[model samples]
Target: LLVLGVPPAFALGTNKFAASCASFTSSLTFIKYRVYDGDLLKYLVFGTLLGAILGVKTVLLLDSSQLRIIIIILMMFVAIYTLFVKNIGNENKFEGVNKKTIAIGFIVSIVLGFYDGFFGPGTGSFYIFLFLTLLNYDFKISAGNGKILNFVSNITSLIMFALHGKILYSIAIPMALAMILGARLGTKLAIKNGARLIRPILISVTLLYAVKMIFDITNH
Candidate 1:
């Protein structure tokens, strides 16, 4: 009955569904490691599924333009920080995760997972930033861990959309393969180059994507 509560007009049509699935699959290509790790993956899967249910309901009522604006602003902030801030001697800043950081991670995970389910663009970037800044994870490690969480969120969202008949399998299958390939390449790069390399790529991608979103918002 929850599905029925959503207006039929808001249901994802064939084209939009296909686009979303393709986008999801394409995103998977950038990570180098396995998508999930032990219990954390399991928890992320559960969390993402739960978040998706709520996200679908909320997203249908949200203003896409406004969301785009918010995302662009976030990207700008990340770009500024990356460009000006120095990571020089702070390598040991996040050597260990503390209780507060864990709490923050959980909260951010849920919130970001909801957003990912609702509308994904810079989900991976957000995950990486949260880990690096708040949790003190170095760039490469954060990217590795981000992939795990991102994969869980993507899979869960995909499942939810599939159940609701909002996914286009034809697009999803091929796109997923592409994403997996991209993820492998991205992961390898991150591992080989370490934090120094990952930082620049992250900044570049975030800013470029943000600019694209801003253009989209303005054009619409």
Candidate 2:
């Protein structure tokens, strides 16, 4: 959408809002299949809601150049670490959510959700990583609950976008229909294949988004 000459904020906002319905659908599927962790979700969803509410104000105040730079730096690290590190996110390991994990989830969910609302790219991937490392969840479970939290943030932020009249329905509607099908396929694969499917895709998308953002920065 950005490549199509849409303004950055509108493009991001419209995409997030459009895809939100699909995300919600995916989250429900994850929950219906009994793979989702409701206990973990309580912490994540609460934090994301608060963070997303603040995120609208934060992004509206920040300069676009600064926002791009922050996203670039963050994704640069995510790409490098995930791509280079072998055996990370490769297997399903179960460690119950401890105090440390709960604390970290509370922290990162806010930070990540703020980013989700303020700047949308890579939000899902960020959630996956945060869950794997902090919440002691395996890759598949991370993805399941991540979709739910992502949807919550999206809903909170979408309301703000709608109130401000920032969404382009013509663009958003078509994109949304496509997203619903895509999200359904993605959730199915995540449930069946787990980390093997998610790892490479996550790394690739993160790298691609990072590189594109850097390119946009230089051109600007």
Per-candidate TM-scores read 0.76, 0.90
For 1-220, candidate 1 gives per-residue lDDT tens digits of 1144533213332223433444344334333234222333344455655665566566556654457777888989987786787872136356444566556667767787787767767777887787778767667656666666666566666556666676545644564566556655666666677767878888899999898887766664
Residue range 1-220, candidate 2, lDDT tens digits: 7678887667767887777988887988899887777876686778898898788777766744567777777777777777777677666574656776677878887987788888877898888877776556777887887888889999998888788777889889898898999989888888888878877777888889889888887876
Which stretches of candidate 2 lie above 4 Å from their native place?
A: 2-5, 91-94
User: Candidate 1: deviation at residue 70, Å?
Assistant: 1.0
What is the lDDT, from 0 to 100, of the residue 172 in candidate 2? Answer: 92
User: Which candidate leads the pack in TM-score?
Assistant: 2
**What would you estimate as the lDDT of candidate 2?**
0.80
lDDT of residue 11 for candidate 2: 77
Error of 2 at 150 (Å): 0.7
CA RMSD of all predictions: 5.9, 1.9
